[model samples]
Target: MSDYKLGLDYALDQDRKDELKSYRNQFHIPKDKQGDAWIYMTGNSLGLQPKQTKAYVNQELNDWANLGVEGHFEAKNPWLAYHEFLTESMAKVVGAKPIEVVVMNTLTANLHFMMVSFYKPTKTRYKILIESDAFPSDKYAVESQLRHHGFDDKEGVVLWKPRPGEELLNYDDLETILETQGDEIALIMIGGVNYYTGQYFDLKRITQLGHKQGCNVGFDCAHGAGNVALNLHDSGADFAVWCTYKYLNSGPGSLAGCFVHERHAYRKDLNRFTGWWSHNKQTRFNMRGEFDQLPGAEGWQLSNPPILSMAAIKASLDLFNEVGMDKLINKSKKLTGYFEYLLKQLGEDTIRIITPKRSEERGCQLSIQVKNADKSLHNKLTEVGIISDWREPDVIRCAPVPLYNSFEDVYRLVEKLKGILK
Candidate 1:
């Protein structure tokens, strides 16, 4: 808000009025040498652990040790239906129905599996369209998909890039690309929220554009899920995938989530790599019946998941379900806006924010481009106990997570940044 005031008292007052302020106490924030909490601004990279995570994980360990094979059906939360427990809560986080959402493989693996079903290519329509600055893993995965299908990786990839000297991607540029080459594009896959720029794309608009041109559409929402309102079901994309490690606050290398629009939930004809987990629950152990694929996003599974990892995910999802995205996002806008407001006061010529200005156009991240700055500036931020991420060149990515970051955290960050710049 433009009315945001200056100084420490203003920040303290904001935190006092914050309805979600108590949530900060629920997480285990990292500490410096003196045991004081670090100013953690990297939730976009890896989220802080919740205090309840240990208890959640230990319960599963106890079940495994006590019940062994019978834990599948007899445990407190049955291993047989472990992933099912996460489905409804996670669906609410990403705006999908329970049947449309499933916690599955890692980000890129799920992307590859979704591609197998949605990236059908013909001789004339063999190209895939992606944002020019998509996360490196997404670029590599899509390129591998092209080569796997016998197309030249370089030629089969069409990039919807930002204009020269521009940081944010424009819809007009994307429209032009589709108009000129839409007929030859087989799939349109883009990051729901870009990693570097923190620009949250209009998923429904992009999906409509792709579908209008007879192209299959999907999104890698690794950066969007739990950070914003994705509305995946309403977007009408064929599929989407996201990881739990970032804004979801699941542990590092936790299981990822996948979404298949309800329309495609029962499409048995869709090609996918499968294992026993993808078979019908009733006939899965029969060992003599025909292949019976499970319906919905669960149909993409290739193996039974690791219980420890799922336990961690369940711990995080429970918090998400309790707090809800609405409350988190409401706090996020005010927190990030205050950050932006303070950053601008450092002199616009000193640092430039590459992320979108509109709250709806971006998440909590604010990518700051410091003039004449290098990695040393980032190192300085780290030395001062401000945990943030630095991209190559000049941008320093900071996400003041609404879940645990206080308004005081944002104030202290900008104050520290102001000193570093001086």
Candidate 2:
């Protein structure tokens, strides 16, 4: 299939030819007791640490130890303005303007903060819409918002579900939901990439559809951010939120990124939850002055962020800046395509891929359904040092992350799956 050969030699040859091969060396791949690197395919869950992350994080630790209070203004990166250093590169990764992006609170926190400003409910338009299979955290966040606004969570939530027996969602189904309940919906919050199916939605199309129906649109891009070129600004969504730990390669529980479209940058009339960090930097220290909101996405900040976490983010963004999303995405397509090619060779009856076959409609992840298999298959994979994620009922999710995972890794993964199934 597609001229792909089944052998370790072919995987090695492809790795040798890969332009981004050097990037793999930059990460600290986990090793077994025998000193072999585990075939890690869970970058969608948590990325491996970059080698330079230690030095980056240590810099802040040393600055704090040596400089204390003065480190806020005198550290090498300057804690007071540390987040600004990340703005440009992070913006490039997500395809947003520098003014529209800010690295702030964690994913769910940022989502709640964004909802404060975006989820305005009226008596006539009080419902919210989300995918039926959205990540649990997002569903919780939306449901809580409904309860907070004095609406019955169950009655106020509308699900854009897949057709009967379908694993993937159809845009037409989403359109049908909007056409019938559009007037009653106040917000449309959906995941940019559906986690279980690995289906990447067209953000711009969803935005346009929701806008036509007079509903505010936003996206939880946790699975899409660095794995796919979100083109968030071009998508015209009101707001977006994503964690940096997954594809961004920041450490676990690291600060998340938020995007407020350029159009909303200067809308002072929009209600927001803010604190001292949201005050204009020019007069922020002038304690006697009245509240003056900073323009752009920075206006959403509630407090000064942890410099250590920001350092890790900076370390990761620096790499993204050098490699650029264009080159990374190119390699991702080839790598994931090869994975699909190899899996298909295993036979359609043995396995089924829920992710879209078209490259444009998905990212690095492939959700494979092993026929009549259970978690024991996944457990055996782990026993053999193949680190992957298993979703409930069925489906093993694997991501051939372009930053560090190799073609050989993909090869060995299939080989392991073959053995386990046999």
Kindly list the per-residue Cα lDDT of model 2 for residues 197-226, writing each as its tens digit. Answer: 999999999999999999999999999989
Q: Cα miss at 205, model 1 (Å)?
A: 0.1
- Which digits, one per residue and each the tens of the lDDT, describe model 1 over residues 143-261? 99999999999999999999999999999998999999999999999999999999999999999999999999999999999999999999999999999999999888888999999
Per-model TM-score, in order, reads 0.99, 0.99
Candidate 2 Cα outliers beyond 4 Å, as residue runs: none
Please give the CA lDDT of all the candidate structures.
Answer: 0.94, 0.95
Off by over 4 Å in 1: none
Residue 308 local lDDT, model 2: 94
* Model 1: lDDT of residue 264: 92
